[model samples]
Target: MGRSFEDARRWMQEGTKAFLDAIGLLHGDDWDAPSGLPSWTRRHLVAHIAANADAVGNLVHWAATGEETPMYSSPEARAEGIEKGTRMSGGELLAWVRDSAEKLEAGMAGLTVDQWQTTVVTAQGRTVPATETPWMRDREIWVHLVDLATSTAFADLPEDFLEALRADVADKRGEVPEVFGTLADVTAYLAGRPYDNVALANGEPAPDLGPWL
Candidate 1:
């Protein structure tokens, strides 16, 4: 089995390539098009993905240094950071995202394999091991890639990451209401849905997902 760090790096790189390819398909005229992420345009989704690469980088830094680091010290600052990054022109935005992802990959690669198992306290107060950070990175890239509104679909996500995600969601199955149906149903049901709306899927959405759709 591939280690979590290896899985995360591979998936993150795959996602970045997909994101870039999707962005390349967009012309300036298409910037106004709707992304699958409701209320945000394609530009907004791309910018958010780029910003999150850095955010994941922050988490990695915390784990590597065993120091307390805050990407945005306050909720207001966090909002401002996203708003500012999202407002950049398409070329600038994509460049920033691409560059940041490269930097992040390099940073992640520098960590000792043993560091992958070291536990750390996140800015949110939850304790997690370094190994799980790749899962976090994978989720960000894979979900936002869909939110970017590419035709890639959830089924296109790597099997390793999807299976890991299926397992992760299963682990939290209790926290998610039973209305979403079976674990696989919940997995498929939550596709393209935002995290904040996850609770809603537990009921009306009937979470239906498979390779076909």
Candidate 2:
């Protein structure tokens, strides 16, 4: 069954906490280290995650007010925000991330059922109901936690969440492999990440998947 907004909100909170805790383990210099994402450092990933919270919050505000507040003024502005955030000192960036996440959570908590059902635009340009916002935030923090490369892995995710992720990725990619090791491995593979630990059915290498939003 699909998760309710309350369930999704709980997951989002837990996932964001886990991601924040993982990031807390990193040393100052680790911010400059490369993340699992290509061409993005830990700093870049952190900055993006922080900015994403504020952007999503904009959508929440729109849903509540029936106004057309976009997640970003433009794609360039969004990119520029991340770039600017990446240059902040480690302390500043961490504070920004924590503050933004807290604000978003509080905003979500205040939403009425009618408000949650209101339509809003995603940063990717797709229009979805506000109830979808929690799941969107859930995906961001959970996936980016692994991308942080700070000791957390997909295997560390809750089993139920892993199952949901598997289904989500499968929906996007289609054609599940016959010999996947774990739900986490399947999700990682479907998300277009390296799945060195995933065992193929025919002893062949994992196939390259197209980008997944």
Candidate 3:
């Protein structure tokens, strides 16, 4: 069976805590270091994650109140927020991220069964039920934790989550690689990260995959 709303919420909570713990370990210079993502420093990534919680929480509010609360006013506004967030000091950034995460958790907790089923628009312009919010946040926190490049690797993720992620990526990417390894390795490769451990069928390296959602 696929994951339920409760299951996704639990994983989202766990992933949030793990990501925050990893962020807490960053030293003075470490915050400015380049993360696994191109053109984004650790600060930029954390800020984006923090803002995402607030944005997704907006959808939850819409679900509960039937108000039309969009995640961001515009795509340009979203980009501006991230750029402005990068200027915050490390301590400020950490605090904002934690507080925003807490706000999102509280919002989700207040959702009733009916509210969970209400349709809301995602930042990507897709209209999905509020129940999907948890899984959306789950994917963001879990994947971005590794993208932080703070010693956490795909191997550290829960095996079940890795399996789900692999299937999801495969479905979205349309072409799955023939490489073989643990689900974590395949997931990492599919996520557009270099995985030295995966071996191709013809004894060559895994081919570069296109961007995933």
Candidate 4:
């Protein structure tokens, strides 16, 4: 059978739990440390995750109400939210994480099967079914968990997910080079993440990877 919203939602739930689990282990001072992403501290990564939940909730809202809602208020709103989040106290930041997730949960509260068929535009302008919402949030949660730099790596994610991610990145980044390794390693290289698990067949540094959304 084809995948349903419930299927995607399950992935979302699992990923969210994992994200929170990683954060639960953080030391009080770890928030100030640098993340896997360059120039972004753990504070920035956490804020971005929280802000992303809210943004995905906007898409859910659009689907449920059939209203024209874009993911962000404007192009700058995402950056603004992250910056604002970074400045928040630890407790406040955690609150936003919990509450913003509820925004998505509540928005998806009573979606009918038909509503799941509603068309929505992604932040990248791709028109997709409403069913894609949870998966969007799902991918963000899992991928950014690595950015937290708390011993979580792309190598730790599911093999199926890494393969799916490879296809996704390859589509966005035309003319991808072949890389061989565990699914996670190849996925990391394809997603433009820092990767050491892969190398050129001739032992040269591989070309830069495509920037994943």
Per-prediction TM-score to the true structure, in the order listed: 0.78, 0.92, 0.94, 0.91
Count backbone clashes in candidate 3. Answer: 0
* lDDT assessment of candidate 3: 0.87
- Per-residue lDDT of candidate 2, residues 126-150 (tens digit): 8899998888888889988888887
Worst 10 residues of 3 by lDDT: 204-213
By lDDT: ranked, best first: 3, 2, 4, 1
Off by over 4 Å in 1: 1-3, 173-186, 191-213
Span of 10 residues, lowest total lDDT, candidate 4: 1-10
Local distance difference test scores for all models: 0.67, 0.83, 0.87, 0.82
lDDT of 4: 0.82
Question: Which pairs of residues clash in candidate 2, taking residues 3 or more apart in a chain or in different chains?
Answer: none
Off by over 4 Å in 3: none
Tens digits of per-residue lDDT, candidate 3, 82-188, equal 88789999899899899999999999999899988999998888889999999889888999999899888999998778777787777767867688866788899
Model 1, range 81-124, lDDT digits (tens) per residue? Answer: 66886678878877888898887888788888776666765545
Q: Rank the candidates by TM-score, best first.
A: 3, 2, 4, 1
